[model samples]
Target: MRIFISSLISGFEQQRAAARRAVTALRHEAVMAEDFGAQPNSPQIACLRGLRESDMVVLILGEGYGFVPPGSTLSATHQEYREARETKPVLAFLQEGISPGPEQAAFIAEVQAWEGGLFRGTFRQPDDLQDGVTRALHDVTLANATGPVDERDMMTRALAMFAPENRNQVVPTMLELVVVGGPNQRILRPAEMEAPQLVEHLEQTALYGESRMFDRSLGVISGLDGSDLLLRQERGASIRLTEQGSIVVRLPLDEPRSARGFDPMSGMVLVEETVKERISIALAYVAAVLDRIDRTQRLTHLAIALRVAGADHRGWRTRAQHAANTNSIQMGHGGVQARDPINLLARRAALGLDRSALIEDLLVPLRRQYPTAN
Candidate 1:
């Protein structure tokens, strides 16, 4: 992949060299203004053209905002960044411990504010810049290799694996989360899945502690069918990891239960605090799982879907009410009830840097379904 390195060329010569070396080390072509000699078009025009042709942009910001050419309000680097952000992924790095000028500070703030496609990092030295750039480029390379996926179908099949035999049985309300990652070539070998270390790692990272998806038990059912690794709890929760790097976790949510017959008061109460905590724990576990797998196999991207089942009659309440009692807050007549699943696509970098943003992105729509309480 061709990566465009954008920054002020005057005082940032060493840093730019470092970034170029890092990009070339990964076997990716580095497009820099320094490399472009006499061109038919002006310098700014040539720089913009080069940035447009690149697959990704590595934006290095220092204390200076660089030269703003004639007939243009923005600097050359700024122009490249504006154009790159529209179409390509931008990996931004800011120099640490140095105060920036007003314009440069504003530019940095603007870049940081756009968290969707931008991944931000900080470096104190040339070597630090090189290392950060190399790692970022590697991640982008892996993301590019992850082919297209049918996320809806993937979620459907994953849910089927944990479906109950007796359809009439009233099961507890559950939150089913599915994450699919891969290069679409290979993920985990069957032998690797059964390794004692891998099982131990999963138990420690995902299945243990108070926030665990399943109950603490010695009975862990591990099986291999074709190219998938299946782990299940005796209760109801189950986890399926595919050779193509897909993970499906089905676990029950904490909700008020009906003792005997149909109780109108007994319905799904999604407390705001509890919902946020659970989602955070689940995301952290998934991130740990991916990191563990990344040691052996590279992952491109993650397709994450969060589905809440049996929530037809649901109530949204605050943490204070939930603490008082599960049934403290009665069913509300208002609030948009959501039956559809929440699907999200995240690059590998976003999982680490923009986790809070990811949580908000997933929960914002879900939260809107509930009305504000008095």
Candidate 2:
């Protein structure tokens, strides 16, 4: 139900206004769409964050004027489209005066390259945009809560398609399955085992969403647990995506940097840009994982050192050493010990997290480079 709305702050005031109204009308709980006068936060950074937490990214492609980085990707809308195409469905709400690529007859070659209706484009008038948004929400709402009756079976079918030769081809970069102790079965393995290259076992599952489920199913989320993970909900908080969806996630992987494609069986996720957009996605994920671990475990230690050394944003090593001398905890790439008072009580601790925010910046874009292995 939580959805994100994003549009060009510089060029499409009318379109952005319409979306703002539509979101209000539909009564979505969370709306993070903002207009930086079409020139906000270096354009790149702003748009990137706008698209991060969105369950469904509704972009306004009106006026066709906004800053977009060249070469790596084209057009803000196009970037959103391509990124959303592989991970989530991108809905292009064309303004009245908007133009299409070209006449079908003239672009026969271009048309052929398109595949299985990855994204959808729709046209709407100023008066009709609200109603249309409402209708779209109606469909999106049903989709988010309840999934198709055969969703599990479909995933089952997809799993069945896996073979021994493709083992590495389908391996998951991150594996999280709940190990339930039968009311009294002895608990052995700890929760969340990072990809253990040493372990050998068939980790396949018949579950739709997560391998290990926590509680009750709230609504009709048949699509998500299946091959379809992302959904557009007019009013919800967190969105769920499956490992398969992660395969389609984008990375900044392009020529110079690429995100290596993933296959659960293959167990490969690379962080090179340009090798393939898919690899970029992998790079983004790699960064996120590193960040999560660093933030949860490393940051705390580093912070301790940083504080003891006088919070001098500069000279991290010296500060770290001083902090290490104060606290006796390690810091840095190789982890060095710092003995100092990190002011650990300055902030309340979280479960390996301080707060929840977008893996924005390079994460999602890099995700674009990673490809879902065939």
Candidate 3:
């Protein structure tokens, strides 16, 4: 497999070379920015292109945050790492026994917080990093040899939990999120979903200190097909826990009475803040459920999907636009969906670390569907 090596060039020349040697020794192609002698595009573009081409990424974090180019908020190394985490497998190595600068330290913390797509280690010298990389790559290869889980199939199963007639009659202008554990993860039994602790965790966890996502007053917790658990709300919001270890949350987004002044028949208007809050709540609930089922902090492969349905002729509005009473930009699409498999830490604390970035990643495709403003 081809691997991309990403790091700051000035401070970690030795480490980069060590990583390259390790990759070559394993008979893998190591792609680095230094090897690109001359390219028509800028260095950032070239580095990202190399990263996109590679199957895996080896990220080395040092004391410096590297150079932040003009018109970019993040350093090149930071950008590369972000890009790699979204798609390719990443093996991250942090330089130990040294104090990183404020920005670099924050970046390191952010990376450590990410619950998905990471194989992390620490090293004091180039040799240690090289050995770690070799071992990590071997582990990843073996894991891949088992074959990847079918994310589309998992999504289909999750969606099937909601009956077609019920979905059409009850859930309109809804945000549906599903998280399914991969084959390697533990398969939750029907009894586990009925555990008192799990139900309490779902009802008690507050989304914003006071507002809870699941309340007994608004919903009823019941059994489904003798194997799955369902929490159906009166207001069209619901949560389904399947024996196959999938958590599906459906929240209605359209309330014509609440969002007055707009013609409800035209389409739904999605507020940025409202959408963010709902996604955050759904993820928090998923994390809580995972924690309740299995206490292990080990990485678990998971397939996650987010879908916005009944979105034909929909519109999206930012907070600023809403305050100014400006019109929302038309989505020009029927529905939006995003699905990807990830290796996650499966803990609430770990999910909190990169939750915003994860949410943004899921929203990117939907955002792109909106027409450009004049």
Candidate 4:
């Protein structure tokens, strides 16, 4: 992957260097101003070209907004970010405790206010930036590998591919293989997979076959393992899923049936009301699930971070909508505006429920109302 590193040229030279080294260590190319050489073209043109060429952008912001290019409104760095957003994934890192000029502050505020799933965080030092980037890279990889699936299908498919002979032992053996693994921890133990089935499958895939279905399936499941759906941990020479893994496992999701706008036999359009009803129920289910998740969840935290920029007297539902827009978080079915779980959390906080207590004291009761979900 080619990663474009964007930041002000001054005051961030070392940080840029660190980022380049970090990207190189990951065996990915880093595209930056230094790579452009003494091009006859303007720096702004060069920067925009690099941004467009890259697969992802790592935006590092500090006190300076950098120089504005001739005939352009935004500073070069800001312009690059805005342009990159149209095509490439952006991972923004803000230097902590920097007092920016009013213009720079406004740009940073806009970034903070964005309603998309662009990853952003604060860093105090070069090392902090490197660590944050590393984590972001892992998240990007997982997201690219597989779009979200309900947990049951994720696990069932994992077992069928990894331990095919022991497919009946899906949940228990998966608990033994991946549930205990967390980020960067031991993720799988083929030996502990009940019959060495997983190891043999990989060995056979590598030795034969034009396309390795086992590898493809393992890639998606392992991506889930990295995403905290299966908490990875080192357990005495093996790895296993943590307790949270059990809570997430559910009855296998039914495959969605293909639907058409018009019925062939009747030569009539399907009832819009029926489609709307199905969507409504799904929205309710989502609301119930979100209501159970604690405030510490990333979506909730992102919403709170927006408060610092200004909540604009918006209602919680509106705020959540804006957050979903800004952060690429899925909100709900259209026309099904159930109460947002994050809003409930903010209200509970206002009522003097401690942040730590909100999940168990408030959210858990809501979860019990939807017991099957819990």
Candidate 5:
């Protein structure tokens, strides 16, 4: 995430620097007016250009309204924010002690009213502003990766709910059942095998206990069903993917292309170009979450777990390296530990059968937000 820091260079310089460090600490690029040397264009033009390029904007309001470029009604800071809010999301922080001038206060009020812009509390210490920016960035990253309406987020939330010891079994089973054909295939679809037969197949593969697979598969079904990504044939006799599910699989909607080499009914395979594209997009989203592991360790852990499953399916080497760098998850023996961090965290949180609290904490909010999710 390239975060544009918009503020007056005079009074709020320290706060701006703090925000820059905070954003850099999270591994995101920070764009500030100070970083760019004197520009030939009007200062307003230069600032607005940077804001336009930014993924998100962070506005800091202090005692002064700052400069008003010739021929412009609003000050440079307010003008940059006004233009940025029109396109990108904005995060505004007002200083605590300094009373803004009338124009600045009015601009603050207008910013608070902007749709999609977030207004946070006033800041006194530089650390306060830093913390505010950090939290806001985390929320934005998480929301982008796993918001209520996001399909991948819904899938990840579901995967996090299963007991840690069983994730290896559960995730592979879900992937195999949902995705058909190709080198990365895991297991057969539910419709192809009866409950008894499915259990037998699991035993043959030595992947999971029949009973556990049965229980976990139901959970997967419920989550996907609620997300409208999966559908069961009359009376639950068989299961099939919804159109959204097809999208997950990277199956093309164009009839001729979809039918050319693969079975349209077979759904998305790892081989498709669309799957590659989705993996790329998903990696970018996961990167932001991974960057903030310091404050959001558990949620970041869950996010990596979800990504590892998808990465393994797609054979994404670069994605694996990125996760490993953050200590979120890894490859080889380290990878096993990465995937099963849930059980260890659970054990540390509590004893005996009550150890799922860690997972619950991360998932409960998502469940509430998406009440329809099982």
Candidate 6:
């Protein structure tokens, strides 16, 4: 596929070189379009026309590198998004650690509404650049193909997509998912999202622990729709529901192996022997996951991680609409209950998931980090 790089040419020199090499390594003919940076109005428009001819646009984001052009409102990257809105495709690669600052987010929210494309992780260096870009591009390709993408799938993929070393950032997504897998494929809806469904399906098939987690998450059928609940497939992902439309928690996932290493941060680091010394990163991953994960299994997974990290384990209580703070207090640690609907610890009610598989991903590392009592 033909790809175009729409970036400010002057200040972001290092980013430019990295982009060129990365795109070259990906074997796509690359275009710099430097004249646009010098004279953003006329020349940039001409460059955009050139980019319009390409199949995909790679937005390299930065701060103070103004290329938004006079009279026109959209930034260079945002404009390219519109350029491909009706046809072709595009993906944004924002700088890591740069949370959408107010003006930036307001500016982006407009383009995000205008164009529907996947924006991958924030990249810092050139070493992991190629892999990161490739992964993001592949996801964008999938998302472009899938359309809007299942919200849960996007975050699930995003958390795992980046270099686990930089696990400090808090990256979240739109929806929740209760996936299942084996013989048939399905996507769960918010109302239909039940942890029991996942547990029962895996049990009937006699699936093992890791297999259950891997397989169950793979076979999500459909999500419930209403006021405050949602579950969906992220756009552009190559997932197909069976013609029957039954919420059957059975089917093979496109990539099962990747799910094996699946530990998207729960607001904490993915700590283990291999992670070196990213305690801070782990802490961040755990903290973010604590807030991001709305499902019970994920919450339990969070609790397990906190415990393994040797934390003062505290069950999540929906103290307020805001966040779960350290100062607040709650009840129980072993599992869940039926009453706590919005309760993160209420495994069955909110997450609607069974005990083992849902919590397994977060717990396995804990087991590896700290063995159980005999």
For residues 34-129, could you state the per-residue lDDT of candidate 1 as single tens digits?
A: 889999999888989899889889999989888888888888888888898767778899999988889888898888876433346899999999
In TM-score terms, candidate 2 sits at 0.34
TM per candidate comes to: 0.65, 0.34, 0.51, 0.43, 0.41, 0.38
Task: Give one digit per residue, the lDDT tens place, for model 4 in 115-151.
Answer: 1234577899899888888877776665444333344
Q: What is the C-alpha lDDT profile of model 6 across 1-374, one tens digit per residue?
A: 67788666677777777776777776776666852455645766777787877877776766543556778776666666667655654455666655655556775555445332124446776555556667766554442342332334423432332222222332321111122111121234443334456434434332233222223344433333322122222321111122112111111112222445642222222223222212222322222222222211111221111221111121322213112342333323433222200111221111222333434444343334322111
Off by over 4 Å in 1: 21-28, 35-49, 61-86, 91-167, 207-238, 255-268, 295-301, 310-374
Please provide, for model 5 over 1-374, each residue's C-alpha lDDT reduced to its tens digit, 9 standing for 90 to 100: 88999988886778999999889988999998888888998667787888888899988888888878788798888788778865676778888877777998888777665521133556889999999888878776754553233335434443444333343442321221121111111123444333454324333222132212122233222224443323222212122322221112111211223434544322122222322333333223222212221222212112222222322222212323332442232122224323321111121102111223433443333222211200
Report each candidate's C-alpha RMSD, comma-separated, in the order given.
6.5, 20.0, 9.3, 19.4, 19.8, 18.8
Best by TM-score: 1
TM-score of model number 1: 0.65
- lDDT against true structure, model 1: 0.72
Rank by TM-score, descending?
1, 3, 4, 5, 6, 2
Q: Candidate 2 on 134-173: residue-level lDDT in tens? A: 6666655643443223333333332333222222232222
Which regions of candidate 5 fall more than 4 Å away from where they truly are? 115-119, 147-374
Per-model lDDT:
0.72, 0.34, 0.69, 0.46, 0.46, 0.39
RMSD of 4: 19.4
What shift in Å separates residue 120 of candidate 4 from its native position after superposition? 1.7
Top candidate, metric lDDT: 1
In terms of lDDT, model 6 sits at 0.39
Model 6 poorest ten-residue lDDT run:
340-349
Give a tens-digit lDDT track for model 3, residues 1-374: 99999999997889999999889988999999899999999999999999999999999998889889999999999999899877776788999988888889989988877734346899999999999998888776654554456556555555554444332332477777777765444456656777877655555553222335644456454556466677676666777777656787888666434445754433446666677778887787777666656443232555566766655455677656655654434455534332222222222233545677767776766555545321
